[model samples]
Target chain A: MPETETFVSKIFIAGSIDAVWREITKTDEPQGAMFNNRMHTDGLALGGQIRMRTPDGKYTGVIGEILEFDPPHRFAHTFRFTHLEDAECVVSYDLKEVDGGVEFTLTSKGVAVGSKTAKQMKSGGGFICKTLKAIVEKGRLPLHVWTIYHVLKALSFMAPAATKSENWPLKGNGDAQPA
Target chain B: MKTDSFDSIFQALAHPARRRMLDIVKDTPGCNVNDVAAAFEMTRIGVMKHLAKLEEAGLIHSEKSGRDRRLYFNIVPIQLIYDRWTMEYSGWWAGRMVDIKYAIEAGTNPQEPDA
Candidate 1:
């Protein structure tokens, strides 16, 4: 196989596995841990399409296809950023019940070496893990994150109309369709 | 999150050797113990000890990939520390730093020399 990089981030969340799983897989509201992006999906099924959009629904940041969707344990997807021009990468989440709480691990594979996606993935993984821990343990986002959420929501109107969820429907093939 | 306070992270980062070890692991993702040990003149056991401390602080995560354990530097702890200290003001500071850089590149010298 060609050279590719993998990043793994693990966090011990002081909460139940179900809670952690719910936070990661929530599709109804914006996920504060994930930059306040509300996940839009047909359902949690293998090969199903997925999209992460701004809370205000002005833009979609990421699109993916579900690879694995075992409840409360494993969830894997092929992630592709709508704005980035890189090949799709696989992201997986694993949750295990530990003594005090659940151990959550986020893994990304097939990342092109030294690509912009790699840089974003590296920085984003840590932020996601840290925010997820805080949200799960404290039941709220950090003050800074809360401020960012509001700022992002307020500025979402400036996002390109091509990124609207209506333009990128979840009925396409596994490949990301251009709007 | 594992009952570890910021003190643990600070202590892990206190030693220069440990900091260098972290850099090695970060530069070479999916590296193994031997790969890291080869970079330092210290004994393998000494390197392992430092790695242990880094792992204890959640700075490094190891996964068993075949017979060799793959080591990856985790940045969450450092990010958490950074987020704790800097808030919205940090963005303004960062913007100013970028502006200073551009001005310096253009020979504008926005800030006056220190007295």
Candidate 2:
């Protein structure tokens, strides 16, 4: 019967295994307001606490810990959002060398297939995987770049007719490219 | 774009107040310092500092029209940054990874894209 566990999501990260491994294991910081500015981790070693603070400054933090820690290959932890619900799952990051580069797969299970808990877990799981991909690949915050993009887009809307006609700062001919 | 220019663009965009000023400059092309400063709660000098940053970052085009300096929003740097980060990565994460693989095989390759 399709294995009794629930796996959330996965993605491929194109980078060296050493580089990818260093990024995932080196440091831990709060991923902005999503995690209530708190992703406290005692360490990445097996049995270390991996506290993920959910939204709300007053709500009690979820208490999860490192369950598996195999450096340069696998790192799994208790993915729980106790503050939101009794949501409990196992989030695993597996890095394997493939044809081009390393493929990082994030899997989370222990929640129902189509349940709200599953969705939340998937979102979080996807976020972690994407964050790793962005860091190892782009080497910057994707959201920050995305934010600048929207700001530029908003600014472009107010451009006068001449601004489009002139294309003053652009490199090539004045085709009036869209931002 | 050059990496230094890219860094300046991001550094200039790192402020919310500067972002708001950029919006004002966009809505009012050829707007003078005073015209842009009126929207912000800070002193005119403070506002000018932010405007100067945007100008330096190539995010705004400034013109000396008669007695006043008018500013217009420039989006080229932003577009290039978008292309570099999003367009380059949105697709071919692995296909581009293939390029990295070849780069690896080709030798230490001074342009190993971060190695």
lDDT of 1: 0.84
lDDT of 1 by residue, B1-115 (tens): 3643788889999999999999999888889999999989999999999999998888888889999988988887786677677777886898799889988887777686534
lDDT of 2 by residue, B2-115 (tens): 122467888899999999988988666557899887887899999989888887676776657699996766555564565466654554585667677787877756354554
In candidate 1 chain A, what residue range of length 10 has the lowest lDDT sum? A170-179
| lDDT, candidate 2, A127-176, per-residue tens | 55555667777776577545754564455445344323222222232112
| Chain B TM-score list for all models | 0.79, 0.71
lDDT of 1 by residue, A1-179 (tens): 44789998877788888889999898767788889888877777997888898766658898999999999999999998887788999999999887788878899999998788988998888789888999989999988779888887778878766677677777634223222
Q: What is the fnat score of candidate 1?
A: 0.55
- What CAPRI class is candidate 1? acceptable
- Best TM-score among the predictions, by candidate number: 1
